[model samples]
Target chain A: MSELLKNTIRFILFILVQVFILFKMPPLHRFITPYLYYLFILWLPFSLSRAGLTVVGFIFGLSLDYFSKTPGLHAAACTLIAYVRPFVIGLLISQEGADKNYISPSIVSMGWAPYATYVIVLTFLHHTWLVLLEWMSFGSFLYFLGKVIASTAVSLLLVLLTELLFFRKQKFRTNTI
Target chain B: MRNVFLFIRRHFNFLFFLVLQIVSLSFLFRYNKFHEAAFMNVSTELTGRINEKYNGIEYYFQLKRTNESLVKENIRLRQLLKENYEAPDSNRRLVMDTIRVDSARSILKYNYLEAKVVGNTTALQFNYLTIHRGFAQQVRPNMGVVGPQGIVGTVVNVSENYATVMSLLHRQYKVVVKLKNGAERGAIEWDGLSPLFVTLKDIPKSAKVAKGDTVLTSQTSSLFPANIMVGTVYDIVPDNASNFYTLKVRPATNFFNIEYVYVIDNMQFEEQKRIEDSTRKKVQ
Candidate 1:
């Protein structure tokens, strides 16, 4: 199948699974919900490029916001992650994200620590903006701050766990190396 | 210009992704529209159905506690009914034949509509309780909500089949409560902490307030039926810094662990509400 078709299908499946099933599951309420929806955007193809990745992340976030009904909160947060993802990866992995080609972005290419950091930082940024938008005022600053931190931590753990459990990316030998 | 076009062509896929994302984000933020309003608002039909189905299972599990509470409430209601009149049990039972008949009919009247709790947030800084009752259920804003113990809070927002209740735990919750003996009225507000201790605000320094005194909802609240047991005066300390007496009221109803509640619909709530509202308008 074409990559676009595959990605589109994945997007629908992820959102359906998220909205209809996962979002409604109360047992997963603790440490899972807010982060569970990010898997689709995270699973975008390796060759998506910086601008592509950023844009995809933004749309993915907006979709969540659209579903979660908090207005632009998710979109804003998702955009922040998209914008920062490339730079954070570049800084941590010492790999030129601009030049590298891969089928999937994963620990096999980026290394465990760097990939984890990338996910954690972006997820945190996304959650912070999203939660701040939910509150919409500084009057409940303490409450919003707590939610941002707690939700980010939970989201990071979920993403990391999913990565560990379901995925093992196909890696390039890079014969010259 | 050729270079720009070449650059754009080179980054077309990424640009497509970026543009789509930006457009989606703007659609959300700029318009501030909630496409997923239903997910957050499982407050009515959705959550109500789910709760009803699960309530059967939950009911089975909570059989012991539920029965115990039912028995306890029955006893309390019996005692209240006995205290109110000198008549025999059968006559009172006939009067209270309807489920809608309230025990507080001497000084107050009520209409009870059964509502299931749809969504409740306890740990949040300003927690709110949402129920499967609203305009369709004939629930209006400012109507009093009471658990078995006493007053829980007041209805604030109403949708078609759902409404949000500002729990007594909320920071926004403020009602004038008066000590039964002293008749000293003060504003009661949650300290944004313990749901139990509703702080008595704006009391004069000289009010002879004491711990263990009966604290009840004052006439100041048009929303609530008068003399509802708000709490018992738990502690009395003079605010020397400010010319007010602060009392820590241990609410009659333990709100922290509350499960079932009754929404008190006073027959004259609107009449009193309009009078208070119009008078305030004239004064302002």
Candidate 2:
């Protein structure tokens, strides 16, 4: 499939699954809410400019916020991740990997460890900001801490699970070091 | 001017991020409460129609449960028939009639409009329930929504045919409520912890609150009528800051099972708010 068509389908599918199916699932305990919707931004092709990435992230978050009814919380969270995503990607990947065009930031494109780090860093940032904004004011320090930790773990797990299920396997090569 | 232009070009990405954040945060803060305008919510025609479509599919799954609740409510209403009560003395009836006539012929201060729950969320930090009734059906923002068992939420935004309710499960949601046995009112708030529980704050230490004591929406509430079922006290502890009790309340409405609810409109809300606003203006 064409890259544009594939991503467009993925975007709509991600939104539908997130808002309708995952949101309907009962909370894991009282703290964890599994949010995999932002993976749409994470999986965007690496060639997209930073400005374009931020704009797309903002729109993606805003659309989710429209359904979730938290107003700007998701938008702000997504934009923050989008802003930091390139730096995280650069920090994790080797210089050669950075130079080559990455089709998508999946396990196959960037080796498993780097892709995992990229997902972890961005997902954690997104969830922490999201929880902080949701709370708005500091009512209970312990409760907020617990929610941030638990939600991030759940969301990160969901992102990795999606990567495992959907992405193709990396081809094995002879040792050459 | 050249230096300024160069600076803008250098930090364009950061500037874009800042601008987008500012715009979004403004939206977040602007429509926090009840408003007539249809901004980003389930109330807009496009979103509402989509949600209604989803609700139509989900409705069948809840059919048996919804029917059971409706049947229970019917039985309760049936038991309230005037014939079930002993005939009051004629003198007392005459006095009641006189009182009613003096107070514009009735004491009922609110009207209830039945609405169907189209889309709802209980797991989110700031949960909202979308209902079928909206401005076109006289369902204005700030009206109270109550399930068959207890208070649900207040309408925060509205479009022509749909409205969005900030459910009791929301972190920012607050309502005035009191014990059934004592009139001392306290505020109810959720901690975003559990869908089944909420905290009642500002109850005086002197009040005789006990486990299982019924908590009800207070008379001071402008959105809902007095004495609507809210919750029951499950636990109580004194606030460290003051001589106030914080009661853990188990909300009566099972938010997970809510399907049908009644939207309550206060007849005198506008008049009361107008007069109150004038008093505040004079004070200022």
Candidate 3:
């Protein structure tokens, strides 16, 4: 499948899974909500432009917001992460070595350590922005920190599990969109 | 002009990112204000329909619990039926009737419209529930909603066939409540820490309070009828600086498992509001 078709399918699947399954899951804890939909933005092909990335992130988050009844909380967070994803990736992976070759991020392409760092940093940023926006207050700073940490941990775990489960053995095929 | 065009070309991606961020933040502040604009919400037709379709599948799993709650509510209402009680004596009843008739004539102050919960969230700071009833079912904004056990929330937004309720778990949501025993009125608000408890504030130190005391909606509230169950006092939060005592309350309705609710429409709300507004206008 073309990279564009793959991402299109992934977008619809992520929204459906996030809204219909993950959101509907019984609240395991007050502080823990697993957000795996943002993984779509994280896994987009590396060739996409930064502006294109932000637009896709906005729509992705807004689609979830539309279903979850939170108007812009996710949209703001997702856009921030999408805009920052390139910088984080740039910091971890040099332009000449792997950037020219890698089609998209995966556990195999980026290796275990760099991929883990990439997911951790971006997920933490997304969760912090989302939790901060949802909170919109500094009254309960401790509670806010607790929620951010807890949610980020859960989401990071889910992201890693998804990478391991689906993309563990796949080779970096140069399929341009 | 040439330099400006070059500048735009150089930073177009950053400019686009900033614009998108600003739009999202504006939406965050604007619609997150709750009652200001209700268009970008789950109550809209498309989102509501999708939620309803999903809830249709989830409803089956909740059928047994929903049935039990409905049966319990049925028993409670049945017990309140006039036929359940017998009149004492003809002479005493005749005297009592004259005294009670005036108050009873105005008893039809609130009407209820039943609705099913299609979407609800208790984990978020600003939690909301989407119900299946809306303007089509006479469910309007500012109407109080109640579950079978106790108070749920107030309707904040409505569409043609769906409405969104600002859940009691929300940080900004508040309701005036009084101790069932002392009748000292106070406001109940969530601290955004827990879904199981809300904080009751402004009850004077002079008022007698206990951990197990029941809290009920006060007469002063325009949204909810008096005597609706708000919660039960769970703990007393001590404050040395203030004369008022803050009580932690366990809400009677289980927000985590709410399936069905009744949207309460105050029949005289508009008339009462108009009169109050006129009085304020005259005073001013």
| TM-score for chain B considered on its own, for each of the candidates | 0.70, 0.88, 0.91
Select the stronger candidate by TM-score from 1 and 3.
Answer: 3
> Model 1, A84: alpha-carbon shift in Å?
5.0
lDDT of 3 by residue, B146-168 (tens): 99999999998888899989999
- Stretches of model 2 off by over 4 angstroms after superposition: A95-101, A168-177, B33-38, B41-43, B87-108, B238-241
True-structure lDDT of candidate 2: 0.83
TM-score of each: 0.64, 0.90, 0.92
The sequence of per-residue lDDT tens digits that candidate 1 reaches over residues B154-261 is 876666787767777665578877888878888888765454477887888877777798888886676666787888888876556988987888877754345577
Q: Root-mean-square deviation of each candidate, in angstroms?
A: 7.6, 3.8, 2.8
Over A18-68, each residue of candidate 3 has an lDDT whose tens digit, in order, gives 887887676678788888999999899788989899999999998888777
Best by TM-score: 3
Report per-candidate DockQ.
Answer: 0.22, 0.59, 0.58
**What is the alpha-carbon RMSD of candidate 2 to the true structure?**
3.8
Q: Residue by residue across A66-167, what tens digits does model 1's lDDT show?
A: 333334556666666666666676687646642255555677777777777778776777777666655673356777777678777776777777777877
